[model samples]
Target chain A: MADMRTPLSRARGLGSAKKGTEHFWMQRVTALANIPLMMFLVGALVVHAGSDYTTMTGFLGNPFIGVVMLLLIFSACYHMRLGLQVVIEDYIHGEATKLLALIANQFFTLTIAVACALAVAKLVIG
Target chain B: MSEQSKPARPLSPHIQIYRWTLTMMLSILHRATGVALYAGTALLAWWLLAAASGPDAYALVQEVSSAWYGRLVLFGYTWGLFHHMMGGIRHFIWDTGRGFDLKHVEIIARITAFLPPVMTLGVWLAAYIYPGAL
Candidate 1:
């Protein structure tokens, strides 16, 4: 098996697109970040539940909460993008279709991140 | 040049052959939960936009989200978040190339499946039991 050689293999770049390890690493990194962020988010929501919009806004307006939320938004968007990219790659067979879906995933995730950031800013600065 | 005809080789060990194990079920559920979370992100955006637009817009969002349909969707989102969170942790374990053994794999899968719903139910229960606590 070690001695067997194919000329095409030497010419071909990294096999399997060389993407698996990066995805695996990013997923773990996000997972670690989410451990604290998720706990904070759930606690924040529970604490603010049943409050009016003003109250909720005020809670989020706190600098500490605002920063934690920024972390959460960034990590969640990154993780979501990675997860959906794989899903699109697996399910969408056509190269053009897959590219479109991947683009859509990035667009949507970025939109969510920006929207969440603006909302946080409104609460904090406004 | 003559092209030699060769008999087709059978594919080995496909998804259909196995008695589905816990890890297999969890693997598929992770993807399903991921898709669910993707939809939930849209709802989060809607909530944020509503919050940013001030009282009138926020009120409208509140009205829609406070209704029965809204609660149902929130419940689904809550469960999706929990399930996906646990599934992510499982993936983290696998990322290190650990926990591939049969017993640990099944244990983690079972925990992932059961833990999220329990946590969601607990949170919802607290919401109902002590409505003003938050």
Candidate 2:
């Protein structure tokens, strides 16, 4: 058996899974995606910051804005999950607690993302 | 598997006496900013749900978000968002294995550290004065 990989490479937790660059790649992808999406979102937020009910719903209810919001929610939540996963792995020493926290982190992120998506969908379609 | 009562491995670098550098400070801030954004998303959810719910709810959220305390939080959120983004960019550059030189790294670190507040202020100003220009 010729295992040629360096100990340093192996120790780095390459992929944190089976040759898995998924987490690292996804984090960067979402980070890149967030740049432009945040611009769009910040613009929308500024316009709607102090706006009234009609103004708020009216802008958000637009099909374009609704789609963008959905995209942003998805990307941001995934990024948040990945980021928190790193934090959890680094700091949480107890195996059980780390596992629980990682699971909870995804669930929490999904709940927020879903809630936001539902709100946007309702505004858009209704 | 039997666990040893007195286990192995001592963690090093002696954290208490560690000298903080700009890059190190920004590295920690990135995670802090990330957690802040996680909490801040609650406000976004509230606003959207309020809009979906009705005018009353919408107005209520708006009232709170426009209040001084609300504005302060919003401003901090804005800064956190931008700063984390800058930190992300810096890391991305490093991930690509470019700009590891001390001078370049410090320059990027300084920019990431200092620019967010200014950007946040500029954003809010543009938000108020120009009112749709950004």
The sequence of per-residue lDDT tens digits that candidate 2 reaches over residues A1-126 is 599988887677554476468888999999999999998998877675556677778888899999999999999999999988888898898899999999999899998899999999999999
DockQ of all candidate complexes: 0.51, 0.46
User: Which DockQ value does candidate 1 get?
Assistant: 0.51
Task: Please list the C-alpha lDDT of all candidates, in the order they appear.
Answer: 0.82, 0.86
The candidate 1 chain B region of ten consecutive residues with least summed lDDT is B1-10
Which of the CAPRI classes, incorrect, acceptable, medium or high, describes model 1?
medium
Looking at model 1, residue A109 earns an lDDT score of: 94
What's the residue-level lDDT of B24 in candidate 2?
80
lDDT per residue for candidate 1 within B9-104, as digits (tens), equals 654776999998777888788889889887787777777778777889888878887799998988888888888889888877887899989898
TM-score of each: 0.84, 0.87
Clash list (residue pairs), candidate 2: A15-A20
- Model 2: residue B119 alpha-carbon error in angstroms: 0.7
TM-score of 2: 0.87
